[model samples]
Target chain A: MAEPSWSNALEALADNKFVLGDQLVDVGISAPELASALAAVAMAQGELGHARHLYHWSHELQGISKEIRAESGKALSVLRHHENWIELMVSLLAVNVAARVLLERLRQLNEAMVVSKTAKMLVEMAEHITFAGEWCRRFRAETGAIPGLFQAALSRQSDAICAWLRAVDAEIGGGSDMDMANAFVREMEMVCGPVTVRHPA
Target chain B: MSTSVEYRAYAVFARSQRGGPLYQIGFVEAFSDALAKTYANLTYDEENWFELCVVPLDELRWVIEPQGVSAKGESGRGGAIVEQRAGSAG
Candidate 1:
């Protein structure tokens, strides 16, 4: 990709963080287990923190006090609150994986500040990915021989996830070798199950 | 967590300085080391530690007692040091 101007990409990435953070706490409140709730809250904090940093980096903030950007109109519908625990897990998995794809692309910017911040965020995201994958396996195991519960959820979110990624690729002005949407689907399928991203080659 | 793997207890350790020795701070119960390490950092977030580590409770060799021994008693850990010697004496 011709170096992502990073201006719009940062804005879009920030929006993802805002939506993901909100949905985490919202869905996490109904989490049956205390550990799950706590982990969700922690992840929410991390996402919001990333959103704040991204906004700062892109100079999207109006003033020093107005650091973090609010949720944009463009955030994906799939990122919203879900009805049940499994749905919540799937939503989180999608956002977590897609965001990592974007960040990996962002890492290509290779500037000192961008590289440092993305590196830290990537570290936290590794944990998030681990949590998402573990939850999917756990949820599937709970269904006990009933197949497709995880796949069903992934299928539901796949379209929106692909759209969000396409936007990221476009916003980044990706002329690079890596197709983010395809990369996202590959990583996502590795975590949950097969995902057919119809859009983006 | 109904379908989740059994959660394992992990002993958490951290050091705040560059050369500081890792100190055993506490423990967290988690399904894997990734979660355990995250939980340890999340739970013991008071310090700006330079490093953190989490090891499964089962991995530790029991130099003392292998049985369930409460550390809540007068004994420091395992509650077997003084009591076992007294028991053996009798």
Candidate 2:
């Protein structure tokens, strides 16, 4: 049996995906191209599917029958709506990637179901990340759009993400907050381009 | 004013088994190679293809054209051969 913290974290993560999925479904219509719009809708469906997949795992493994509800009022601040595609892309990376990282930490338990189910979920998650990352980088590359939006989005979400990490990391045996932050930075630099992650001195 | 999306067509191919010839399952139009892939995956998701790929319509060099091959899916008599198939199919 898994710990309560793990179960609760699973529930929370599932809800987070739900929120991101909901937001994406709304913004997906505004995508610049038909292909991106389709991808957005597909990705939204994928997010909702992932949430259900996790909830199923929790129900089966931990017997937590919590509903997969995504009330935006309680969502992570970083996962909120944005006016531009750049910020949307950032939020996608911020939340979706964070969810994957958290799952990685949870998968450390090495439960048979956890490993197999999350492994499948992880593959799809990586593709979503790649899609968001590529577009985010593209937004940065194109001129006549706002500058520093990526940096701003990353900075704005730092505190909430850090707090969330601290709250859940110890229970799941994940690493320090800096480790999570660095992981995000490393991914940003990799997926986008050179990026400066502003954190505490 | 409506935002205009500039894009190019990509021919999507997939194979059902290893060592088999790839079949032209469909085509998708997108602004970039990456986005084209997402479109391809979503559009051609009916099967568990063993392999899949997308090629820019401009990049393919034709040594010869197949009979009944239309450059357009509907407009050209060989419909869907439009280079990304184009024009009226007769």
Candidate 3:
């Protein structure tokens, strides 16, 4: 197979298409798990691209060196070597952030979709909402807006609420609704400190 | 505005104070290390207990995470705890 261009890899991941066997063989990955591995790598690559874009924006905003400025646009360079864990992790964080932002855009696009209609659905959606806010504020800060610590704290709390949602999703399949709700409340306390989750009458 | 090569001071930490975590704290936009250091120190000193560090823009650790604040005191509970405890301890 021909060498994978950056664009092809990103498009594949975004579309959720499995990487072909030829590509996997070229990379020396086994045949059976090639699809999963390819998906992971493609997703990782896409994430790096998004991170690179954000990092470049921040660098431009902050007036860093031209050399540094250039590197910000090439997040894929950070992941060239599997051993580059720091850059890889950074790239992953950026992707996680982009996922969140996309989720929010989806929600805003369809305002009628209230989360609380189903506990499981709500938790899943809430994670996306909270994560989006966190990434946006960080993006702003990195780009020189200088958000206060309190604002950052608000982002963290939003994450906590998202965590509570995940727990509810897990419990929806089997546990009693009341117990699931109670567990979610407990998780919320762990993430954001103590808080009440009173339901409307 | 100037394109001078400079370091961005950061206060790196894990999400839950765990042994192994990503570099959550991000870049400082100041020009000089001293200015960056000062900014990092003033801002992160209390939160990460002043474990401030510096890196160039190219070297910055960029593991950003989403977080939120709660009045219940989970996120930045330090400010509340320290102020309350300081009076009693002193």
Please, what is the whole-model Cα lDDT of each candidate in the order they appear? 0.73, 0.71, 0.35
Two-way DockQ contest, 2 vs 3, winner: 2
lDDT of 3 at B31: 40
lDDT of 3 by residue, B1-90 (tens): 113334344443424354544555754554444434434443444454423465655564559733433233554534655666668998
Best by lDDT: 1
lDDT-superior candidate, 1 or 3:
1
True contacts kept of 3: 0.00
Predicted candidate 3 versus true structure: per-residue lDDT over A69-130, tens digit per residue:
23322222222332222222222332233333323323443434222212342343243223
Write candidate 2's Cα lDDT for A1-201 as tens digits.
Answer: 455657666766777778778778888778876777778788889888987876776566675466645442346766766776666777777677777777776667777866877887888888788788777766666555344666677566655665666567655664665665566556656776765544556
Global CA lDDT computed for model 1: 0.73
- Which predicted model would earn the best DockQ? 1
> How much of the true A–B contact set does each candidate keep?
0.30, 0.39, 0.00
lDDT of 1 by residue, B1-90 (tens): 454468898998899899879899998888767667777877788989999899998898877664446544543565565587679999
Model 3's CAPRI class is: incorrect
What DockQ class does candidate 1 belong to? acceptable
All models, DockQ values? 0.32, 0.30, 0.01
